[model samples]
Target: MLTISDLDYRIEARPLFDGASAQIASGWKVGLVGRNGTGKSTLLRLIREEVENPTAQSAIRLSQGAKLGWVAQEVAPTDETILEVVLAADTERHALIQESETATDPDRIAEIHMRLVDIDAWSAEARAAEVLMGLGFKHADLARKTKEFSGGWRMRAAIAGVLFSQPDLLLLDEPTNYLDLEGAAWLEGYLKKYPHTVIIVSHDRELLNRCVTHTMALEHLKLTLCAGGYDAWLRLRAERVAQLESQRAKQDAEKAHLQAFVDRFRAKASKARQAQSRVKMLEKMQDISIPLAERTVPFTFPSGEEKLSPPMLVLEDAVLGYGEGADILRKVDLRLDPDDRIAIIGTNGQGKTTLVKSIAERLPLMAGTRKVPKAIRIGYFSQDQMDELTMGETVLDHVRRALPSDTKVAQQRAVAAAMGFSHEKVDTKIEKLSGGEKVRLLLGLMAMEKPNILILDEPTSHLDIDSREALIYALNDFKGAVLLITHDVFLAEATADQLWLVKDGAAKPYAGDLADYRKLVLQADREKPDPATKPKTAAVETKPVAKVDKAEQRRLASEKRKAASPLKRKAEDAEKRLTKATAALKKVDESLAQPDQSSDQMQALMVKRGELTATIEQAEMDWLEASEAYETAINA
Candidate 1:
């Protein structure tokens, strides 16, 4: 069992954990959750004994004889081979084995041999190999020097090393950050069957919900332990919040009743005793403390055009790849409608990214014809933007370049604000920004286009859970088509309705849910192919609609139009309301900017401005909701 007895920690001058106490059982898998700066990592460091607990009486202790496993954040390039580095995780066993081999004394050699046997040192290499393969490393790659691999691949090696150690407790901090979808799934399964304790810090909601036995949340500078996984914790938390709010409301109402009685009859002789009693009761009443909320950054993607006709894009017998040599994807026939929400998933080094690039017009089709409506605007977020972003340019300048020439600086700032770049942060050079911040800038740039179709490739790579949720929220309200190529199963499951699997030069519709698909991928990867197996056939293409006469299709469209007319009218009305509210908000802001105003006038203007801001948010949210409903009805 792990116990924290009033442990406190601080960063610089700010206290993160103030006498926070929590207990975790021996075998429980804990999910540590909180906001970005709430110090999830710091808590992990504290557990690892790297950070000093400030409370003198605090005791952060684990069970006797318990061993810990921690993966390093950065694994520097070394002369060691990947396999050697992994095997090095068991330093004690390795040292014993070396001593046994070189020892001249028979007694010492026998003792070392017994210790090696106890630790199962003979299977260490095999275990390391298994972990390496599970993390997407080939047999040939295991002997390769760690320095030869890219940063992401090297991170995978580091993860493998940590897993191979198999300590009593494992500290996995975003273990899947650099992992492929297949690798992530494999790791999830591996952790499930693992016998040891695990505490993970991940933004993958599904992973957290599925893997964790308990949740330890750092809220309002205190660690609160809840029994159960992410979903259970959320359910319990919501109920608690509701109960607290209801009780507080009741208490306030009673206090108000007594307050009024005291106010009215305090000076009257007839009811002096009763009024005094009421006042005393009022004084005795204690205020119920509401739960404190951390600062929230509200974000929304810019709204797309109201109208887009299908099919928005199509490819007929197309070949996709970087160059003319060997194609990564061959003879792919695909169509995208304005209502399509497709997620592309596959193994690493496969054709998912290639397909997205082909669709985005970043890579030319090597073979067949492609067609797209001239009026169909596309908003694309590419993985390559991490390298393509100008190091010298500011965030605001990049947004300005991407936006229309007619767009004002004020409008650009609004878009930046939604992107989480304040006026000050906006001026920072791109080179000084973090990977996640860069991705946010790119997302903001794409959002500003307000395109009718969005084609994204690994858009969630560097994003945290909050940003990922914000993106998902925006996508849910988006009326246009979304084609997402991502390894993030949580994001994909939340946003996509259709799943496409890309493998072995073909793209096909996946016939199952994410869980089933993960099984298929992992099974395929782990199981060795047999020569006796039959040759594979082409993937069976499933058309959205069966072939019908043009007249019949037209009739169906006409019927849909008739059914959707009311919703369409409501959506248009909402759009108008939003426009008017925005105009009113602008006028209020303009009035506030004027100098030499009376204090009372300024106060009223501020109140009016606040009201207008709320009005705009509600109006826009309503508009999106109505628009999405109208679109859904028409497509239904």
Candidate 2:
């Protein structure tokens, strides 16, 4: 158990936390969330006492003899075999084996028995192997040198090592980063049953909701601790935003009233003193500045010609795998349309990546009809995008290379601007681009190709919030068909119109939202509910049990039908408001592009732009609220 009291942390004179206090008690699993530079990692390190000179006013006190295990963001694999690394977790096993080999007395046998019983060694080695295999290490791979693995695979190995430690407290930072969908889901299930304390920093909302019993949000120089997961946090944050809006309106009204009084009594003899007093008081009063909320990225795709029908891509009776091997994905029958925004999901090493690769044409499909429609130009973004960039080329140069025809340098600059590259950033070398920047560059190049179809594999994995939203918006507006492979459930739920359940080395289509799919995937997580956090499902047994099941079912069905009508109306209303705001932003874009815009007209347009920006922001907030209400109603 860890107790953080009035904690304050700083990095290079930047205050990461101020008076932030939270308790991580026994049997607690917390999801620590914040922006990239907000110091979630630093906070974790401070709590583990890995950082020195922590604030005097703050304290992170852990129970005595607490064994801590951490998976740091930057993972380095030593020159040991994977098996050797995993076997290292079982120190008792090694010691016992040593003593068994060299024992000179029968009493030593007693000592060995005691030690084996103490550490539960009879089953621990097998369990460790099970865990490693579950995490996607082949039996052969267990003997491979760790240094030979790629960065992502090495990170996975580090994760396995940490999990094997089975410490009292676990700290995992972006544990899902290197994992495929299947690997991520496996981890989700593992964390669900883990009995000890866990504090995870992750960007995967689905993973957070699956494993975390509590949410800790770092914002505004403080921490907000709450029960439940991201959904609960979103709801609470929305309510707080609403409260701030109300306060802002009240403050504005009071300011207007004070100004009106001041204007009326500025020159009047009797009212002058009262007016001056009011003015002085108002100036001294803390100016109630409205809270500056996060700004959503404004984005819409350009229009293109629509196909006569949904751009269909069909895979028939497919047996896909590498040469002379069993099909990694076998006997697959699938149809994809423009309307089907499918998310390929499964556990790690279960062939999600292989399926994506086969679809993207990066890998050959051994025995199948891979049908792609004519005029379907596919823009495939994958992990290989990082490898495709030339070592010496600038970011701008790489993007320009994607252009089909040789274009003037100025035209390439225009293309870069459309993709959010500034002049200074344009000159930056491809080797120097950050992960997020590389993603942007790849997207910009894809946009230039004017693809009628897009295949994205783990596209959102490296993107920050702003970039993710922008990419989502682009995908939403795209007239072309899309086939996506991602572990981000929120992204899928928000953007996908349909779902694909990838399991048992194949893909199957499902007609449902991501929430439905999530319920299915998480159903396998059968951890016992914490008694401290469990809520009573219904009123206690104060009334006799009713046994009229048929009548009760019919009554409930009738009530559900009755409830649907009004809920539909609310959904329609929200959709209409969102439509109107989207149209207005489009109009602003059109107005700004006018060729003959005069100086005075431009000034007016700027004022109008600000107003429209604020209106769109409010509309988005309202839309989120409305959509949530509609979803809740439907589920209820």
Candidate 3:
């Protein structure tokens, strides 16, 4: 459905894409992957631009009339309900339904009905609700105004709309960044079954492996599309790299043999011709181009020199919340030993954050006791830690500030360097660093004191796969206890040995793995009642009434039919007008879609389309009022 050829683009005089090319077929889910700063987002932008404005010279090209969809931005706060916003995403269905309400021509009305059936328009609301619910929205949230949601929730709503639209070509860039673990898992399943073509830019390894049918790797300023998922791509890339190494090795040996022969025989007149020929042969041989090995800096979380005793931190019967009588988590008894590696898993807003904060001593307990040894040191990493960093300061400045006042400058620089900051990067300002770099800086600062207990909240949200792997390694090698709260299931599965589930206002141990929790989440979403299909309770009558005579009933019916005839005729006339207006609007739309139209002609057609739409809307109102009057008269 999409083809990109010779895509050469530059940013600030630096090459991002140099002759990159790829072709993706219809209904294939492709995961676009690369390390940070590799221009994955830039490539998406180029595709979107090509879709919006096709040109003869453009490198990116999409199938004709294929609708492109993406979460362009978070949904702005508005008075419209979340469900309403999603239902309106299918613009064609919305328009057709409006037109059908007042269409009087029997053939035209039947055609509209058939089209609606083809698109499954009648069940649009239920589908939209399902998408919303899968994204962590409650059933009641469907009726809530978009303005009532926070920024993150609004971003979910935006995602719901695009998914509900079901465009032919869907583009997603780090979609799980705003979701919790449950939501991300739900999205992973949804994409696996998505019918249309999908191109997602994500760093979630599980998602890349399980959801996509192919992997598109962006490396060395080039695009390589491989069959199967991320793991498959890795195997293929490894084989290719090995082949290049073998060819290069063979070529090197041949060159060395020729050189040795040339040196020994060049002065001897008997072998002079052969020596010169060997030199010519060496020059004619082509060198194999092997890519340089990529180096990823490892993350460091230093452990304290003094070994801490067991039960480093403990919370007993704790009621955690923001204030008195406002407890979010109740009766929580948990302990973190020096060897404990615990992961907190639950749905969003289930007090996971509250429990972590309470344990970290960031939030005071309303009731209950939290005990920690006087020598115990706790290192906490949260998204808010990034915000706490000074924008005007450099990486070196933050690292030095976290150290003791008497610590040497050389020691501080060494610490920063260990955190992946180079000499130039150490002096770079915080405001200019990317999200991943900022996370590294935060982790570096947290490691300064060499805390024995680490409480990390969604630490891998901004990290790429390589960095995430590095983090997993660091966490595993560390001697301190780890309490991790992250949406990345892979990281949690790799690092945490114990699972603590936060649910129903309590924190308790879970006896299952991440896969079990995933099943539970999906099952809960399936069990949620779809409002559109829910059965309504009917009122029962308590009193009985006598029946009227047959003759009187017939006379009353006759009078009612006679009284409704004129109103029915008026309704029919309004329907005819609506049908005509809708036809005119369709004609205008077709005209607008034609290529190479004069500017003035295009403007005039757009104006006509608007006017026709307004006319149809007014006719629909008129038809509805007349039809209601006819029914009322007949009932009377």
Candidate 4:
């Protein structure tokens, strides 16, 4: 359990948090949220006491015997092996092993060994390895030195260490920034079963919704703790704001009535005493102010001057990957119409982004050709593309520079306004901007380009909820084709019209939605073979299916039709009878449900309804049997 009371933090003179108070229940998964720079991270730091300011009463109080674990944001180079660092997080086990190794006395050694056994130190290595694997690290990478990995991969190692530690309180910040959707989903599942208090600071809404039990928002220089997940927090926050506005309105109306009474009789003698009383009441009333609603970027992609004909893009038997690299996506044939909105989804490192790049013609195909018009214009939104923006520059300067030199100041102002920047914010430096703001500025610039097709890769990684909603609205109404690669399941489900599954060196259409795919993935995981009892086999190579000649195919088709004709007829007949029986039962039940019906008539109807229901049940069973027979006949 953690309790915060009268928490305050300041920088020099400016106050970040003042008189903020919150109570976090034990074993709760909390998601901390607020606009950028509203001290969400500061609160986390205060809870962990990482900040320099120190005071007893303002400090976070944790119950006795509770352990806390936090993923360090800056995971520097170290001499320790990656796996060793994770395993070392089990301090008791590590210390016991060390003491046991050095102890010459049999009694002391035996005591230390017993402690190790009680702590389950024997399987620590395997558990750490498993966590590293889930976070996209290979078994081979486990023995490697921590300094060998890039910063992003090291951040993943930090997260893996925390998970392996299994502390009473676990803190994570933007845990999904280094994880793909598959890895993030795996982490989500792991945390759901974790019997510990977890507090996460992340922009990944899907992660928040999946793992968090409560939300702690730092807003208006105060803390608002709410029950439920991110969406619930949003609902409660809006309600709170609405309630404030309602009270403000009531206060305004009352003041107006009081002032009117005071004004009408201020100069008259007839109601002098009442006027004085009303004036005094008005003077004593405190002013109530309503906060402005949160404003999000309202920009949409510019419509192309004219719609292109169908087949805006086509890739024939395309092989996709980097230069001279073995194809990760092979023999892919895809066609995109002007109206196509395809979302590419797959596990991490399965080449979803590679497939997207191939479609955008940004990557060269090893074989086959991309058939596209020379005049085709693409507006691509990759997270990496944001790096091209000049740092230390203002958002307005970037947008204006992207436009024509001849574009008027009025038009530029309109563009900035559409990008959620007002006159004052237009000059805010890019270096000082939040992740969401920078991404919004980049997107606003892209939308101003008026391209014929938009290809986005992980577009929602840095966006807040309001900005994500705005992007979804824009994408849904976009005139040209859209090809998106995103980990955001909600955005994919809300915007994409079709889904492309990239796996096993191939890309193809998925005949289901995100929900269906998730179920299949979970079922597959549940059905995975246990390593202890799994049989080992050599990898088998598979050849492409052979094609048959026209005459042979015709003959086979004729045989299949002849075999299936009778069974198909039977199934069709059963289906018709089932429909009729169901309708008859429905009518009888409706007659029996009428409130004004006589008891004798109702009794007769009930008996008839029961008989019809039995008939309908039989028809359903017959239909199922006939359908199975038809399937067997067709296969045979």
Candidate 5:
């Protein structure tokens, strides 16, 4: 629970929040959304500062005893195992356990044990493992040292630690930026069931819509909180904008009529009094001030004049990888026509990139035939293409260098403008540009080739929701075939008509849609066995435990279970209902996302979805209550 009242904040005299106020209820999952460079992250920093050093004049306030948690940065590479790092995140538990070893007083030892039971410390490792697995870590990887993982995996470990800590007020900024589709989807479900208040700043539309209970719009130097998801917020904002426009129009007409009357009658003595009255009425009228609509720059992917023949690119039973005898993907049979729009889907490290690279001719097949017409052109955009850009060079410099030597200055500027870079932006150095700007620049360079097929890998990673929508529009409008690899499900759903699954050393057509694929991913996570449940191999041989010690351990365990049985049963039942309700709601949401449904069917599904949403809300409340009661009973 947090309250921000009349918050006024600025950066170098530029206002980020002016008279902004919001109340976040306990247990509410709030999705903070706004365009890029809109100070969303700054707001989070302010909240963190307020929580850390409370001042009487500060605008942000949290409930007493509420702990705030966030992943400030990626975990530094260390010798600690992933599991140990996550387990140590719960400082209270770790300190208590450490103190228990040296605690000589009986009262203090008893107090530690009671507190551990209250916190459900017995299941801490299991919960940590679940979070790690959902975030794309293998069971074996839990024991691996953090120094052995890459920077991205290290960031995920940081995220897992924060999640496992379960702070009362959790703050997540762009949490899904490093996640693959599978990890993102798993995070969505996990957050839906999180027990405490959450304030997440993200550009991920699917995660916002499916996970958060409330949408917090940060725009025009103000904050507006709305019930429901991003779609609901959009609908409400649209209606408000229309209403304001209508009111303004009516006010303008009234003012015009009053002005005409006053002008005509002010010249006549007989109507002079009426003219004065009309003038006063006009002066008293308040102007309806509507906020200016945010402008989004469009992405252009122009199609070439030449038409390519069918099967413009083909890979027949190809073994694709970095080199000979090092095949990452094999038995791949794929074909791309000039008009195809395909999306590649799979878990991370499943050779999705390898498949795309092979298709784009960037990687040669080791043992299979590849066919392509010499006239066909392919433009490839790698996910890490930004790294290839020279930071010291300007956008115009890159554009000019990428274009033909004969291209005129005007034509170069025109190409840069088409990629959403204005004259000022074109001259700006690459190091000064934002991630989205760099992505736009890369796209501009790619589009200059006038290719028949585009192979784009994770192109939307740095784009905001509006920019992503603009890209979806451009991709659909472009005449060239598109082969996209992205973690953004909304982009995939909007642009791709066919799904290609790259898994298990092969690339093939997937029979289901994006919704079905999401379900499959979530189901896999649910079915995964918790690593904590696995038996550990002993490093050294040990004698069996004494019979008396074993009997005492069993007696204590049985007593603990007996004391919590009733409340535990209630919690289990509530959990079951919540799971069922959530599944039903997901089904309706999936149906609502379909593009080809009839109007009547869509209306029916909308109603069903509304009902299911309410049911889920109530079920969530019941589960929370029951779970708390169970914990209290055990602690007692």
Candidate 6:
């Protein structure tokens, strides 16, 4: 549990949070949503006590015995192997397990057992492995040095370490940035079953919708807490916006009515006082002004009449990767159609980038017969577009460079305007722009080429929610063939019409829509147990057959109920009764602590408490066995 009261945060005389107050209840999963530079990450830092602000009042307050764990957007790995660093997060638990393994003396074993009672090593190891696998790190990769891993892999390891720590409160900043669809889906499921409270600042819409119980929106230097997920908040917020619009309309009508009355009765003596009072009231009322917002981002692709035919781009037995015998991709085959929107997906370092690079002609294919349509123009936007900007050119000059034939100032201005760059921003140097600004600029320039084939490699990587939505809208409207490789599954769902899964080395194509891809993946996942071990629960999930009907649901439910035997059921009932008795004992303790407690009542409460304590210990043992049996049944 955490609470912030009357918080006011300012930077360089600009208010970031003004009178912001919210309570994050126990087990709350919050999606901290906002635009870029709107202080989402700053707010998380404030809560984690990594940043300080003098203006903020009544600093973050946490529940008793709360531990904070954070996955920073920018992570720096210390000198250690991936496994060593992750294991170090739970050093005490690992130490206990190791000591138990080496213990030979019975007395020492007894002492270790007593210590292990407080921290369950079996549960901790299972949870850590689950997290690591979910993050896309294989057991073989765990022993690799952190320094040897790429930036993205290092970030993943850092995230895994944070989850391993199992803090009471988890603060994740853009957790899905470097993850593939599989990894993101794994994280979504993990968060759904996670025991502790979580607060995440992310631009991934689907992840937010799937994992969060609440949406914390930051706007106008204030915080608004809404129940339910992002979609629910969108619906309610739209209604509120409509209400404000209606109120503003009424104010305009009232103002016009007052003016008409004044004009009609100014000369008449009878209504002069009333009309004047109306004018005073109108002047005194607070103005209902519409809020100023960032202009709607332009969404349009270049209008090209050239149509592409089947096999727009082909790769025959391609082998890709760097260095000798380090084959990241092998024997890959892919075909592109005129209107096919292919989404390349795989876990990190599985050649997603290598494939994208080879396809985009940024890198040479190691050994392959690749073909492309004649005179096909390609527009490519790399992940690091921000760093690719010219140092001296202004934004306007950059747009002009994108169009070599367009010489007129008006035409250049129109192109700049279409990309949401206007007035002073067009004049600002490209080198001075922010990451999001640079992305918009790159996209604007790319649109000018009007290429028949588009290659966007993680275009939404550094973009804010608004910018990403804008880009998705533009891409959706483009009729040309596109090869988009991105980690954001929601963006892929919105933009891509087809999914191309890159597993191991080869590319496998899937038909149908986004939902079909999800169904396929889910069904495949159910058939195979997760490679990493996870804690088994009593609740059973029904596996969807070809036709998901009521009969299947009933059959699955009946089977699950039967799987939990009578012995397990009886033990569960006994545990429930014991928990109720324990609550009653706690009430007895409270009553005895009262100033006006009677001696007879106190003596009776003590007797009941002692009996309840013994009963609870026995119930716990029975419950543990029953739980183990229930878990086994579910896993089976």
Best candidate according to lDDT: 3
Question: Which ranges in model 5 have alpha carbons more than 4 Å from their true place?
Answer: 50-57, 268-273, 525-527, 531-636
What residue pairs clash in candidate 4, if any at all? none
Q: Model 2: which residue pairs collide?
A: 182-346, 182-347, 182-348, 183-348
TM-score, candidate 2, is: 0.68
Candidate 6: tens digits of C-alpha lDDT, residues 350-418: 677777778878877778878998867778888867445765578888888777674898888877887
- Kindly list the per-residue Cα lDDT of model 2 for residues 551-622, writing each as its tens digit: 878887677756766755664565566557556766876887675787557556655665665565565556
After TM-score superposition, the amount by which residue 99's alpha carbon in candidate 5 deviates from its true location, in angstroms, is 1.5
Residues 1-636, candidate 1, lDDT per residue (tens digit)? 788877777765988877888888878889988777678887788778775444522467878889989996444445688888888887788788778778999999888988888988877777787788888887667677764565578788889888888888999988877787888888888888888898998877878887788898888777888988777877987888889899999999999898999899999999999999998898888888778755546445555656767788889999888675658998898889977999988877778878887888888889998999887778888886744576567888898888789999999887788788888998877755766788888877777777888888888766677778878988888888999987788899898999888887898778888888887877776533222222123369887987779998899989998988988888678667756876787788778767667766766776676577667666656765677778888788
Please, what are the lDDT tens digits per residue for candidate 5 over residues 1-636?
899999887755687888999999999999999998888988898888832334313888889899999998777556799989999999899999999999999999999999999998888888888889889998778888775566688899999999999999999998888898999998898899999999998888888999999999999999999999999899989999999999999999999999999989999999999999999999899999999989898877777898778988888888889885568988888888878999999888889988888878777788899999888888888898544587467899999999889999999898888888898888887756788998998888888888888889999878888999999998998998999998888889989999999877878999999999988888763335364544244469788975678788778877977988887888678667756776787688778767588866866775576567667666656765666777766665
For model 3, the run of ten residues with the poorest summed lDDT = 48-57
In Å, residue 19's CA in model 5 sits off its true spot by 1.5
Candidate 1's displacement at residue 229, Å, is 1.2
Give the per-residue lDDT of model 3 (tens digit) for 141-186: 8887775565688899999999999999999999999999999998
User: Which prediction has more favorable lDDT, 3 or 5?
Assistant: 3
Q: How does residue 559 of candidate 4 score in lDDT?
A: 91
Off by over 4 Å in 1: 52-59, 74-79, 257-285, 292-309, 324-326, 404-408, 431-436, 527-636
Global Cα lDDT for candidate 4: 0.78
- Candidate 2: worst 10 consecutive residues by lDDT? 526-535
* lDDT, candidates in the order shown: 0.79, 0.71, 0.86, 0.78, 0.85, 0.75
Better of 5 and 6 by lDDT: 5
Preferred candidate (lDDT higher): 2 or 6: 6
> Candidate 1 — number of clashing residue pairs?
0
TM-score of 5: 0.81
What local lDDT does model 1 show for residue 404? Answer: 84
Residue 385, model 6, lDDT: 73
Candidate 3: residue 545 Cα off by (Å): 24
TM-score of every model versus the real structure:
0.76, 0.68, 0.82, 0.76, 0.81, 0.74
Badly placed stretches (over 4 Å) of model 3 are 50-57, 101-108, 407-410, 525-527, 531-636
